[model samples]
Target: MDARLMDATFSRNQPSDARRLYDDRAIRYDNSWHPRFARHMVELARIHSGERVLDLACGTGLVTYPAANAVGPTGSVVAVDISTGMLAQAKAKQADHKHENVQLLQHSVTDLQSLLQLQGETFDVITCVSALVLLERPYEAVKQWATFLTRGGRMIVDVTHPESQISLITFERVGRKLGRPVPFYRVPFQSPDDARRLLEDGAGLRNVVVHSVSQMDIEGRDDLQAYLSDIQHPRIEQAFTIGDADRLFDKHITDWAAQSLANDDIKQKARAVFREEWVKLADASGQIREVDEVFVAIGWKQ
Candidate 1:
């Protein structure tokens, strides 16, 4: 197929930039620290042999493949993700590991009927890692997920701390202050209590366990410079995130410009404002502080 035609077909199939962006960066993510995070999430979920597992937004099979191994041959893992590109990477890994118990499907969480058909069928464990905030309706999604769990079965999900992605959090604050809020594709939980409530009250899951692990570092000059470059990337809309923000920022001026959210002139102005604000916030506490906080929660259906 012609490149242009292929690109058009892809666009026709996956119209949302949110999906396309992950598809575009699947390779890079597979090579990043996310795999470690997935492994850790799987461990925390404590998936057992002979148990059925459903991994949501499986993403490059990070959580999916590991959970597959945990479940072993007697068990099965059905990994679902919205991005075919991401699933493709997971499928490729599937070949090497050849976990015959693993099944990969491409479907959005909102499409319940086409997802794992629940004709009295339920999983022993369900895990969603590093992908809940990306959902269209997080609370509703969790509520639905709970129904898929067998009695006494558990669901594991992770949430980012408000300050986990400080760069983006800071950028959003700057944008809001500038009266130019660009929806940056995240819904963060303000605290551990918020996460616990979401599982207990929102999802109606019992025995909710919220474990948060954190790390902090003083931001050096090099680190701040790198962050600025990320915020300034032209195609940031396509590639903004928190991990490499070590340098990941998406002050996506171009996309916003095309959509008439802001033009080049305003973007330039916003850039200066963001930098100034960032510097102040960074220095207000002496040295800039970089923080990472991730919360892993487990809840039982019964």
Candidate 2:
């Protein structure tokens, strides 16, 4: 979390790292935070039956599978990702769900133009969700992706508000407490204007529109803890050995607690206070609630 450490982590945001990280995470990625917003993107795109669709960075087929269903068997979906692990999982899901309209491809977005040419294809709808920020030059990438769309075809891109998730906030808080800086690898697309500019101006797409969607969900306390525990923070493996990092984190928490509380009784009281604060985060379901905002940008190929 030190500046140098953070920089090192950010440097690993290349295609190779993404492949390895996602390969390890393919089995669990769908069950994680991303799929929650994937459905919304598919819905917003309004993919119609018989339309040809391309799902870029289609991790575990979250958006791809749904889009296939929306388009029905008459349509087709080309789902591509850099990670073989993710594509494998997606293929498995595609088989299990019987989404015969979907096809899987392992290619980075950087190579999409050439790949499309090799396949001699174009699409009616092109979607890249929660993965644009990972690109080194999102503007250029968008521009390239747009070239693959048919005239009047729609291109949809979505990104999360950088600070909107509870897990992110918790990581930042803990980092600050320990005098470390939590690093974000993705380029921040934190506002609607950001999305608009990237699409309409950067990509030269016409009739661009951006929409913001907010979702709140209640999670059980134990469930939240387990979720946090499994978080493989970007480049975390390079930072510290597995159990060592958790031990260091626990020590920091202990030190912070000791400095803030006078005795065991006060420490217990402090714990209760924090627990109530967390509980207050819950919605009517009496589960810990986390609120997040997702921005979806739509543009048409002119």
Off by over 4 Å in 1: 1-15, 116-120, 173-188, 214-266, 272-288
TM-score for each predicted model, relative to the true structure: 0.73, 0.67
lDDT per prediction?
A: 0.65, 0.65
Model 2: CA > 4 A from native: 1-13, 116-119, 166-188, 215-291
lDDT of 1 at 59: 82
Report the error of model 1 at residue 156, Å: 0.9
Which candidate number would show the highest TM-score if scored against the true structure?
Answer: 1
- Give the per-residue lDDT digits (tens) of candidate 1, residues 1-302: 22222223333222253366577677777665577667767777888888999888888988887787888899999888888788888888888885699878877765545554544668999888877765546788888888888999999887766555556655655555665533343445767777888799878999998775432322452222222212111111122222333232343433321122234545556566656655654443345445456667899997
Clashes of each: 2, 0
In candidate 2, where is summed lDDT lowest over 10 consecutive residues?
A: 229-238
